[model samples]
Target: MDQHSDAYFISRVVLFNDQKAFEQLVKRYQKDVRSLLLRLTAGDHHKTDDLAQETFIRAYTYLRSFKAKARFSTWLLRIAYNIFLDSVKKEKRRKNTKLYPHQKSINPESGMDAQLDYTELMKILRPPERAAIHLAYISGMSHGDISKIMACPVGTVKSHISRGKNRIRTYLKLEL
Candidate 1:
């Protein structure tokens, strides 16, 4: 039921083995999860989809362990973030490549007038900075919520957003 609370759905899952309740949770947050992943993956839809699938799988496996200290969505995002970090670590071991495995080079012929879009702008940020900026600005989450998700202090989240924004501003100015 659309009107059902997350707690109700979660309770059903924990007590009655309700798969549908879990599906409801997944459906409610999949777009949000996928969008965040798409940003992190630099718009690699295939990789984003795979990671998103892994995220839900892990979430379902670990649903019983959820303590409800934070919002369910926040918990799910934390799982996604951890999975992304794990994948990044694995990729580094596999190829010893840069962050974006299939990073595209700027076409010299595209000329000086090319302006960086959001994805291009995000590419300039380090992972922690990118995650902080996205959670704060795009997800409309509080600094405290982001700190919980990132498993860091609120001050650190604020610092990440501040530094990330400064980097983006500098990059945009240079691009122009």
Candidate 2:
């Protein structure tokens, strides 16, 4: 592989504690990581930015654990996915405990990005379904790879995609 390839950059970071190498990796994949997080947060730009930052932090912290068997992007996205899950759990706990009475739910109009039907559609799917569908279709990952990133069985990933598609079809029909 070329010197500028992901494998090279990853090796530099892992072997030499090269912050510059990691920075290069971050610059290379920041857009993909942010895009995934933005969708997961339902167009909530603030939350997405926070989650994306956390993803990179965790990735650098655990850089040695990466086996290089999977693509670097996949590993980074897995970190992003786990961070998203943790945030969702934290938010659920906050709501369940009534920690903030004034805190409002995600406001569709408050998102900084364009409010497209795609964004609205993403809001409808459950987190796993949204992640599965996004990784499978948008990220163009195989179900096998998605299973690895999601830490779920391949069957479960398939089921999520199936259900997500059905939900979208049903939703579109109703909206029309």
Candidate 3:
């Protein structure tokens, strides 16, 4: 089978509104996007899938506007991150009324239902820190790419990665 580049599929979707091409793009990038959201939500598969679906929807809606300046995956991640922030804000608002049932607890062992089976590094790092580390190490994104996706400066991305690594090292007693 012949493999097509992301740009080719994107062009097909953008110029021709090709649903199959968009589906191909989704299949190509879904794992990374879903994994990013899964870790971001602390292994909430339901929330992750929901957010991933929303992300793809937004991506498809704006597919024609994609400028080809950054990789398609990075653009999708940026959308996913924005969706996550919106969800966080909505949850905060709901929590103020005591309506958000799944509010994370202070205690890791509490019935917050977090999948603590995530790596020690994932469990220890904050959301931004975890995102930076994941984008850099797992997704093989450059610092600039992460900065764009996280909507932060490159320095912030560097700090998140550094702080995340330091915390992980300290937690595991690997720091000198």
TM per candidate: 0.87, 0.82, 0.82
Error of 1 at 131 (Å): 1.4
Cα lDDT, all candidates: 0.82, 0.80, 0.80
Clashes of 2: 0
lDDT of prediction 2: 0.80
Q: Residue 38 error for model 2, in Å?
A: 1.4
Model 2: what TM-score?
Answer: 0.82
- Give the alpha carbon lDDT tens digit for every residue of 11-73 in model 2: 888899999999999898999899888877767899889999999999999999988888888
| Best candidate, lDDT | 1
Q: Give the TM-score of candidate 3.
A: 0.82
Query: For model 3, how does the per-residue alpha-carbon lDDT over 60-148 read when each residue is reduced to its tens digit?
Result: 99988889888888899999988887887788796764332333323434322443344433656677877898889888889999999
Q: What pairs collide in candidate 2?
A: none
In angstroms, the error of model 3 at 103 is: 10
Worst 10 residues of 3 by lDDT: 103-112
Whole-model lDDT, model 3 = 0.80
